[model samples]
Target: MAAGLVELAGVGLEVERPVRTRILHPIWLTIPEGARVSLVGPSGAGKTTLASIVGALQPASEGEYLFRGERVDLLDAKARAGFRADNVGFVFQNAHLIDERSALQNVALGIIDPTVEADEVTGRCLAALQQVGLAEVADRKAALLSGGERQRVAIARALVKGPRLVIADEPTGALDQTNGKAVLELLFSLDATLLLVTHDLAAAELADQVVTIVDGTLA
Candidate 1:
C-alpha cells in the first residue's frame, strides 16, 4: 500500500476505573494524500471517535497514528495542538458560531497566526467567505443567518486556515435535504484531503472510499 497521508495501525481506545469501556477496536487503515474518505456507521459506532483520533483532536490509546510520515500520536500536547492548528480544519454538525460575531469574525477565528496583519486576516476571511458563496453576508451576525448560510460560514471558517486535511463530522446533519446536498457538494469541491464522518449513505457515495464501522470495529 502507498504510504498514507494519514495512517492508523492497531489503534484502540479504552477507559478504565469504575467501569471499563472500549470505544474503538484495534484496526488498520491508510489514507493517501488528497483522498476523499467517508466513514459511516450506526448511531453508537466509533466513527466520530476515529475521526477525532485521526484529526489529532484526541490521542489513540494504543498503536500508532502517522500524518505525512510523522508519528502524531507520540507528539506532546503542545506539539499536537500546533500540528492541528497548522494542518487540520474541522467542521462539526453544528455551525458552532459565536452568535454575537459577524460571519467574517467567525471565520477569522481560524486565523491562528498571530503575526499576520489584521488587514490581511480580514482580507483572507473575506476571500474564504466568497469562496463558499457567502461574501454578501460577511458582515451579518451569525445569529441572523439561516441554517444553510450558517453552515456555509462554518465551511469558510474551516477553509480560512488552508489546512492540509479537513475533518468533517456530520457536517450536513443539521441541514435540510437541499442544504445538506449543497453543503456536501461544497465540501467535496475543496482541494484538501477529506475525512468525513456521516450517517448519510448518499454522502458516503461522494467519497472515493467508504468505511463502515459497527460495534467499534470495521464491518
Candidate 2:
C-alpha cells in the first residue's frame, strides 16, 4: 500500500475522571496522500471526535496517530498547535469568520506562517478567494455576506494555506441543499487530502471512501 498521509493505529478517545466515558473506540485507519475520505454517522456517534483526533485538535487517549510517518500524538499541546498550523486546514459547520474582517482579510488570516512575506500572503489570499469564486466579494465584511458567500470565504480561508490535509466537520450543515452541494464540490476539488465528517449521505458519496461510525466504533 502507498504510505498513508494520515494513519491512526488503535487510536481512540476517552474522558477519564469521576465518571469515565469513551468517545471513540479503538480505530485503525489509513488515508493515503491526496485521498478523499468521508466519515458519516448520526449525532453523538463519535465521528467528530475521530476527526478531531486526526486534525490535531484533540489528543488521542490510546495508541498512535501518524502524519506522513511522523508521530503526531506524541507532540505536546504547543507543538501540536504548530504542527496543525503547518499541515492541516479546517472547515467547520459555521463560517467562524471574524465579522469585522473583510473576505480578503479573513482569508489572509489563514496564512499562519510567519516566515511568509506580507505581500505573498495577500497575493495567495486573493488567489484563493478567486478560486472559490468569491473574488467579487473580497472587499465585503464577513457579516455582510450571505450564507453561501460566507461559506465560500470560509473555504477560501481553509485552502489559502495550501495544507496537506483538510478536515471538514459538517461543512454544509447550515446551508441549503444547493449551497451545500456547491460547498462540497469546492471542498472535494482541492488538491489536499480530505477527511470530512458529515451526516448527509449524499455528501458522503462524493468521497472516495465513506466510513460509517456507530456509537463509538467504526461500522
Candidate 3:
C-alpha cells in the first residue's frame, strides 16, 4: 500500500496482569488521509482496544505505531498526550455532553490549545456547529436538545479543533435508525480521516474500506 497518514506495523497488545492476556494480535494497517475506514467485529473481539491504540488513548504492548511516518509508540506519556490533542478527535457512543452547558460551551471545551484567543475559539466553535447543522441550537442547553441534536453537538465538538483524524466508536449505536443514519451522514462528510467502529454492516458500507477483526486479529 502507499504511504498513509497513519500506519501500524506488527502492532499488538497484551496485559501481564490478569493472567497474561493478549488482547490484540500483531496487525498491520494503514489509514490514508481524508479516507473513511470502518472497523467491525464481534463484541469482545478487541475492536475498541485497537481503536484506542490508534487514538493514543493507550499504547500497544509491542510493535510500531507511526503517524505521518513518524514513530508515535516511542513518545512519552506527556508527548503522547500532546500528540493526541493536536491530531485526534474522538466521539463515543454516548454524546457525553454536559447537560448543564450550552451546545457552544460543550464544543468550546473541545478546544485544547490554550493559546487560541477567546474570540477565535468562539468563531471556530460556531463554525463547527454550523458544519454539523447545529448552529441554531448553539445557545441551547444540551439537556434540552434531542438525542440527534446532542450527537450533532458531540460531532461539532470533535470538529471544532480541526483534527487530522476522527475516531468514532459506535457513534450511532445509541440512536434510532433515522438519527443513526443522520449521524453516519455527518461523519462521512468530514474532511479528516475517519476510523469508525461499528456493528452495523450498512453503516460500514459508507466507508471507503471496511475491516473486520475476529479473535484479536484482523480477518
Candidate 4:
C-alpha cells in the first residue's frame, strides 16, 4: 500500500475579530516520506497557523487533512489527542520543558508510554540525549540548563518518540550562530520526514522544497 504521509487539499482558515475579518486563505501542500520541507514567511503571514493544522493541533475551518491516508481534518478533541500521540511530534520556538523534572524526564514525556518501565524510559531518554551530545547533563534539572542546552534537550525529546514526521517551529530562533547550527544538525539527523518553519533562508535551502509564504499565500 502507498503511504500517504500528509496531504492538505484546499485548506482555508480565517481568524476573525469582532468585525469578522478573514486572515488566512486556503493552502495546498503535500509531504512525502523523508522529505525535508521548510515553510518560510514573515511574521503573521499564517505560517504557524498552517503548521498547527498539519500537526493536528487545530481543526480546519474548510478542508481535508490526511495523515497516512486517514481523514483527520474533522476529528473531535479527544480523537485528535490520540492521533497526535501516535503520529506526531512538535518542537516549538521555546523548549517548553517542565522545570521540576530532570532532563531525561522531560524527554520521556514525549512518548508517554504506559507499558514502558521508568528505568527503561530513562534509558531511551538518555540514549536520545547522547545522540544530541547531552548525555553528561541528563540528570540535571531542566531549569538549570542554558538556552542552547535546553533546546538540545527539546530536540532529543522530539526524536525520542521516533515519530514518522517532525514539525519544528523556528527551531533555532532562540540560539546563537553556533547553537543554532548544532540544534539544526540534530534535527535533520533524524531519518523521519521534516517540516520546519524557519525564517532563515540558509536553513530553508537545505530542504527538498522551500515554500515561501507571503501575505497569507504561497509565493
Across 132-158, the per-residue lDDT of candidate 4 in tens digits comes to: 899999889999998899998988898
Which wins on lDDT, candidate 1 or candidate 4?
Answer: 1
Clashes of each: 0, 0, 0, 0
Instruction: Output the lDDT of residue 174, model 4.
Output: 85
Query: What does candidate 3 score on TM?
Result: 0.98
Tell me the tens digit of each residue's lDDT in model 2 across 82-142: 9989899999999999999899999998888788998898889999999999898888999
Give stretches of model 4 more than 4 Å off.
1-4
| TM-score per model over all chains | 0.97, 0.97, 0.98, 0.93
**Cα TM-score of candidate 4:** 0.93
lDDT of 1: 0.93
Estimate candidate 3's RMSD in Å.
Answer: 0.9
Of the two candidates 2 and 3, the one with more favorable TM-score, higher being better, is 3
Worst 10 residues of 2 by lDDT: 13-22
For model 4, where is the 10-residue window of minimal lDDT? 15-24
- Give the per-residue lDDT digits (tens) of candidate 1, residues 82-157: 9999999999999999999999999999999899999999999999999999999999999999999999999999
lDDT of 2: 0.92
**Cα shift from native, residue 158, model 1 (Å):** 0.7
RMSD of each: 1.2, 1.1, 0.9, 1.9
Judge candidate 4 at residue 33 and give its lDDT: 74
- Report lDDT (Cα) of residue 78, candidate 1: 95
Question: What lDDT is reached at residue 210 by model 3?
Answer: 97
Candidate closest to the true structure, highest lDDT = 3
